[model samples]
Target: MLLHESQLAQGVFNLTWKVEMSGTIETGHVKWFNDEKGYGFISRDNGQDDVFVHFRSINSTANRKTLQEGQRVEFKVIKGPKGLQAEEVTAI
Candidate 1:
């Protein structure tokens, strides 16, 4: 089946899948982070919009990982309650 057709089928059945049909995985820079609050915003290089990122979404191998301002990162944008939020964030 074609890609869009398959997606339409899934939508009809309410069967969600891990697919990149909507938004894209993008690269950006950490605009700022509040370690105390554990939340930050990323400046998207695509120039679409700034995405909200929480420390919990960060992918790190270290015991203590914190994002620094102006750090390059990669992430996927997902729909959040407030709007678009960043997920699976990682330092580049």
Candidate 2:
């Protein structure tokens, strides 16, 4: 995200820079998940906004891919249509 500084010196000024990379891997815990619905949100360890997670994004070897509440996981963050989403999620 780009951050702006509006107050600098006597005149208004703006400064911005990239605070995070687009493909950074993040660690978090499953805030809530619905096995039937196949979707959930993760509470990021870094304290950023929770990231949306879909069943298809999980890395699993079993027949069913699901996450439990408060389950630890690692994944890459990406910009989804609605907002930040978790991809390649793996239980850790």
Candidate 3:
């Protein structure tokens, strides 16, 4: 055997972008929902992928009444665990 050594890069190759939004009331209908589990998907404009929203993160009371199948409300964009959860929801 022979002595051997090597050096590797010391910095991370991390890349990320920021979510900036002064949100306003927007209409989004519930695509898939489980009221009992307090988790569901909302289909936004342009027909993009539905974003997941959890009851634990909502400012309103943790109940299905605070949300509905086709509710229109205003909220800010947040980088949540499941990605892009609505915050500070208020009726239009």
Candidate 4:
């Protein structure tokens, strides 16, 4: 669902759904990755705190899935258990 600024002004703060209301997608570079552990962090281009990324969150079409350091990517943000995390990630 799309989240317009006006909608947020109306107090739409539901946590059950992944919201991309702002109509903004983010791009970032992989800061580090552990192929064995299947987890890593991405340094957002906006200069925000690095976002955590998991192997399962990647959207890849290749037979082998792996992210290398300095790889550029686009992703959506979700409120994960620990905090904000990258989801629906795809290599850019």
The parts of candidate 1 lying over 4 Å away from their true place are 1-23
Which stretch of 10 consecutive residues in model 3 shows the poorest summed lDDT? 6-15
Candidate 1 per-residue C-alpha lDDT over 35-57 given as tens digits, one digit per residue, 9 for 90 to 100: 98999899999898898898878
RMSD of each: 8.8, 11.6, 10.4, 8.9
Tell me the tens digit of each residue's lDDT in model 2 across 1-92: 54445434213321122122366688999999999999999999999999889999899999999999999999988766466788899999
Question: What lDDT would each prediction earn against the true structure?
Answer: 0.83, 0.83, 0.55, 0.83
- Between candidates 1 and 3, the lDDT winner: 1
Residue 26 displacement (Å), model 2? 0.7
Q: Ten consecutive residues with minimal summed lDDT in candidate 2?
A: 10-19
For model 3, what is the error of residue 56's alpha carbon versus the real structure, in angstroms, after optimal superposition? 3.0
lDDT of 4 at 69: 99
User: Residues 1-92, candidate 3, lDDT per residue (tens digit)?
Assistant: 54333322211211132243435545566555577887766776646556666665356654443467776555555555346765555545
lDDT of 1: 0.83
